[model samples]
Target: MMIRFSKMQGAGNDFVVIDAIGQAIDVEQVDWRQVADRHFGVGADQVLVVQRPQDPGNDFRYRIFNADGAEVEQCGNGARCFVRFVHEQGLSAKRKIAVETLAGLIEPELLDDGMVMVNMGRPDFHTRDLGFVDWQQARARGQADIDDGIERIQLASPAPEYLPSLELDLMSMGNPHAVLFLDAPPNDDLVEHLGPFICTHPIFPKQVNVGFAYLASPNQLQLRVFERGAGETLACGTGACAAAVLALARNKAREGLQVQARGGNLWVEWAGGQSPVMMTGPAHTVFEGLIVLPTR
Candidate 1:
């Protein structure tokens, strides 16, 4: 079967967005990995399938699949692209849209400036929320601590003597994340070496996205992320949010922070405790076409 899809990007993260709502798609029969393959098919960091909302209260529902074909809970960049996609496709006329994801409800609004802003729900620092294990032992070893209701932990570096141990703030933004604040920008080699190590760490049962962040100033952050299934990408929306929220909580940065990813820039805002994080960024349409679903 052939499917119509839009090639979209937010910041630098790219996606193959399929309008499942308008097409009869047998999602199970499609080879997601093939569609996301850089060389063999439509290359993308993830595939976004837009469908009609399962709940009456929501305007739409969407699912995210990584390049490796694993379905994930949340995706901030894709959310922006989602809103743009629906509007361009004539699926929705409202400037603000309420969508359902595996993570939960998220609201995305289109601004007059042509940028999209997403309400990424409250950040959760509970270990249980992140499915983090060995909490008791980590705390006993003085590698973990709680300050201002936020959990911070120290992870031994793989190259201890040569590299400094990483102090990470763990949180769940619908998905798990480990943010490491660094004194300077991290090199590609360092991110390549350490990102997977922390992402697949045994402590994170469901795995985690690892963000290496440098606070450029009180309101500017530079970041790189190794995503759980997609490896490294040009940008990661949720990673940006995770980094900004953690920085705000720790007083390392103030609200309305600008996060610079390799691909582009995203603006994040938070009102301290229990408030939803707002992420603003641009979503672009690269192209659109039809591709046949692989039977095997």
Candidate 2:
């Protein structure tokens, strides 16, 4: 069968958007790895499938699959592309669209500036569900004594050359994240080298997305994320939100922060954990095409 999909990108995080509302397609059964292959298939950081909302109040259901074929709970950058794809395809008429995700219900609004803004729910600070383990405390007080929420802890890389211990702030933005503050810009060599180690660190039982962030200004941040399944992408929306929220928690900056990634920039504003993190960024439709399903 030929599957029609739209290639869309939000802040350089690209996805192949498929509308499965009326189709007989079993999204879960599709070969995500092939679909996200850079040379053999339609390369993208993730795949977004649109379906009828399971929740009556929502307009649609959003599902995300990583390039490695794992279905994740949420994707902030893909969420923005989702709204843009649906709106452009006439699937939804409203500028503000409510979507049901594995994490929960989220709202994405199409802004007048041709950018999509997403209500990224609230940051999860008190839950160990995101796989933030305090190895320091675990070693001293035993694993049973460790608790949840953000804490500064020393994390040693598995690499022999990079033996320096790093201090990272662990948090979740509908997904797991490990944030490392840097004194200088996140260059390609440093980020690509240490990102995977931090992602698969023993502390994060479910693995994690590693964000190398620097405070560019009072209201701006420079960030580069080594995504768990997708490696180093040009941008990561949830990463941006997580980094900003971490900065906010430490009183490093106020609300309305700008995060600059390699591919582009994202605007993030948050009032704290009680309020949803708002992320605004550009979503562009690169092209549209049909892909024939490879026989298994």
Q: In order, what lDDT does every prediction score?
A: 0.90, 0.84
Compared with the true structure, what per-residue lDDT tens digits does model 2 show for residues 1-296?
Answer: 88899999887899999999855677767888789989989999998999999878789999898998888988999999999889889998999999999989899999997888999999877545445564555457333322234655566565545436577777788888878888888877788779887787666767788999999887999999999889999999999999999998878887899999988999999997599999999999999999975432
Pairs in clash, predicted candidate 1:
none
User: Which residues of candidate 1, in runs, are more than 4 Å off?
Assistant: 134-142
The true-versus-predicted C-alpha distance at residue 140 of model 2, in Å, is 4.9
TM-scores of the models, in the given order?
0.95, 0.93
Cα lDDT of model 1 by residue, 103-180, tens digit: 899999999999999999998889644556567667677887876887877889996643579878888889888898
Indicate the TM-score of model 2.
Answer: 0.93
Best by TM-score: 1
